[model samples]
Target: MTARPVSQHAAGTLEQALAMLAPPGLLVGCRRIETGDASHILPGESATILSRAAAARDASGAGRWLARRLLRQLGYGDLAIPRGKAGEPLWPAGVVGSIAHDADFAIAVVAPSETMRGVGVDIEPALPLPPELEPLVLNSRDRLEGCDVAIAGKIAFAVKEAAYKASFPLDGEVLGFEDIAVDLPAGTVTLSNGRRVGVGMSISSHIFALAFVPAGVS
Candidate 1:
């Protein structure tokens, strides 16, 4: 509900708007979503991103096109970012990124591999997470402050998801909700084993979280 900075180029459809709002240190690209058009897919990528579900296909295809554009920024055009067995992006050597969508908006955020150990970003509608899942996600240390239960849940879930994505590339570690605790107001997620990642969360066109592990961390 709160407004975020708008880019002068954030025009056209929802996807177009987000392409202009790439997070710091990232180059984002996006396209209009379409279930019927898989034109955005490149060689060796369709098997990973295209799904039987119409909405899923549209969202994924749009993100792929955006990723390909960002690839241009990296001086590679034919690179195929397939999905791994773990359902994560198979980033080419020296490249990393994340893709996310909320409704009609789909986006890809990419950066050179040496810049980060791992990176991820996610978007959710402003709506809250379901109450029944709260006990499964909220940690004992979490302080929701004065926020409504749903909003608080959203914050925690988004942060945890981002952290998991950011760490997966290097650790290949399957993390449970309790393994990573989220601090909403502070915009951070701390792992149980003493590791922490920087997380940025906000309400722009929707709720979003961008996460990354600094390069020097092991």
Candidate 2:
């Protein structure tokens, strides 16, 4: 899909909103996708391994663009983040990060491994979750106090996705939605494995969720 034009001010606003959700020691960023955004793709970052479709490549490039910038702040220069076997971004040693995008925007977060074990981020439009998927994405244990009724399910969905991404490298196991219990009011998610991940969210411009595992956690 072609990316719609987004004003730089709007992009910056989203980034600012997301920054509030970021914990100490992590860098977060977001940007609007543009035409031929795939040009940001660099050598050593394999697009073919990701997908041949131009749009997919463009989105990947946008995510890496943000990731590289974030990594640079942590004393690293430009580097390649290749796709792992399980379709996750392979960060440099001593660094943990995650990237995600919807059709219009791309986002990334990175932190030193000393401070964080893993970090996951996701961006989604501020839209309601489809009715058919609600039962699958939300569970009795999940809580959404103070969240708007219209987009509550969508926020929960984003939180679960980010939580799964944050936990996978640590646990080495795939998880179903049933395996995660989200508590929006508490800003956390608990995996069936008993790992608790801290959750942060931004509702401006888009629904942005960040999930993180602290360094000393099991």
Candidate 3:
């Protein structure tokens, strides 16, 4: 059977992008923008781009552009844009979140109501990892021993990316691949700092992870 394609845009009309991007149970609102035309509309907030070597200028710029647009869409009114000590994008007062952009696409997740303390989202195209680098990233001694190193690496990369996003607001620390461990099935993450974050996965042909922590937590 063929797999379903991931929907790039949030559900509902263009006006509802904020509502659709906002995950349930969180006080914030989120929206996904794919076109360059939307760039001018973005309000406050800084943007970070994560693109492949081949990503076009327009596509790469979309990540930061979309972030600004989403902040304005949610009524943040000219964001105060700050960067964490590790260079992670920091939102203005009363707002906390992260943004990630890849070769073909970009995504911005934000909180309007601030109910959610911190949020992160990451996506990786379904592809095999290089053979040489697999062993370095995988935890071979663990139950992952039997799995293909390429697959393990892909999962590890996705989880770490998600963790990086989730960790942005708690501190400005830059987390290396070795800084966090992911238990895919359990949807949990343990950071080197000893902080635990909750994880959510969107599995399709490609894999995406959304990691978050309640505002009340450190």
Candidate 4:
């Protein structure tokens, strides 16, 4: 079997998934990366885009490309979005967004940075996280309290990650597994530092969580 290089323009599967989840004010875009397409992606990125190593060029590049299109649709045409100290995308002055990638998938979501503080989105293959991580990610209450629900800990992990991405820019605070906890019943994520963020989940061939907060509100 042969592997696809990062330059192939293979068809992508993320379009319909993104369309289904688009909200009224947010613009979303995604691509399936069979190959990294370095010729275009590298030129589109700068040295400060996460201090990324050569190996990560494809994933980061594809994710950013999708973000660019989404932003353009919202009037941020051909903007140069950089990365911050914590590896977050430094969107235009009034734009907020997030990017995520799996082995062969990448996605981005964006909204006005004024009223909408930030958009956090994450994607994971429909597989269970390893048992070892269950202790670290899932709180004991949500773990044993549930009578008999068949869900892998991956959704919780993804939700926490998404929440972290959306909340960090607003609060400008460092976050950790212990700092953020998932409330399945509430369909929300709570932070130990005193904040509750709204989260929405989508489960198909993949699992996705899109969390958002208004400016100055968590």
TM-score per candidate, chains pooled: 0.83, 0.95, 0.68, 0.84
- Candidate 3 residues lying further than 4 Å off, grouped into runs, are 1-57, 78-85, 140-150
Q: What is the C-alpha lDDT of each candidate?
A: 0.70, 0.89, 0.57, 0.73
Instruction: Estimate, for each residue in 73-131, the C-alpha lDDT of model 2 and write its tens digit.
Output: 99898999988888999999999999999987888999999999988988889999999
Supply the global lDDT for candidate 4. 0.73
lDDT of 1 by residue, 1-218 (tens): 22223332431444444444344556755444555435666668878664767667666767777787888888986677787887787777788888776555666778886777778877776687788998898889875565555587887787688788888887778889989977766766788777787777765446667787767777
- Each candidate: RMSD: 5.2, 1.8, 6.5, 3.7
Report the C-alpha lDDT of model 3 over 1-218, residue by residue, as the tens digit. 12123244431232143233345653322223344423332333223323223333343345555566667866766554444456567676766666664555555566643567777876666577677766665553222334345566776777678777878566667777777777756667878788877776553445556777776776
Clashing pairs in 2: none
Query: Which candidate has the top score in TM-score?
Result: 2
Query: How well is each residue in 14-102 modelled by candidate 4, as lDDT tens digits?
Result: 55665566566877776765454333354435766653554366677778888888878887777766678788888877788999887
Model 4 CA lDDT for position 112: 86
How well does candidate 3 match the true structure in TM-score terms? 0.68
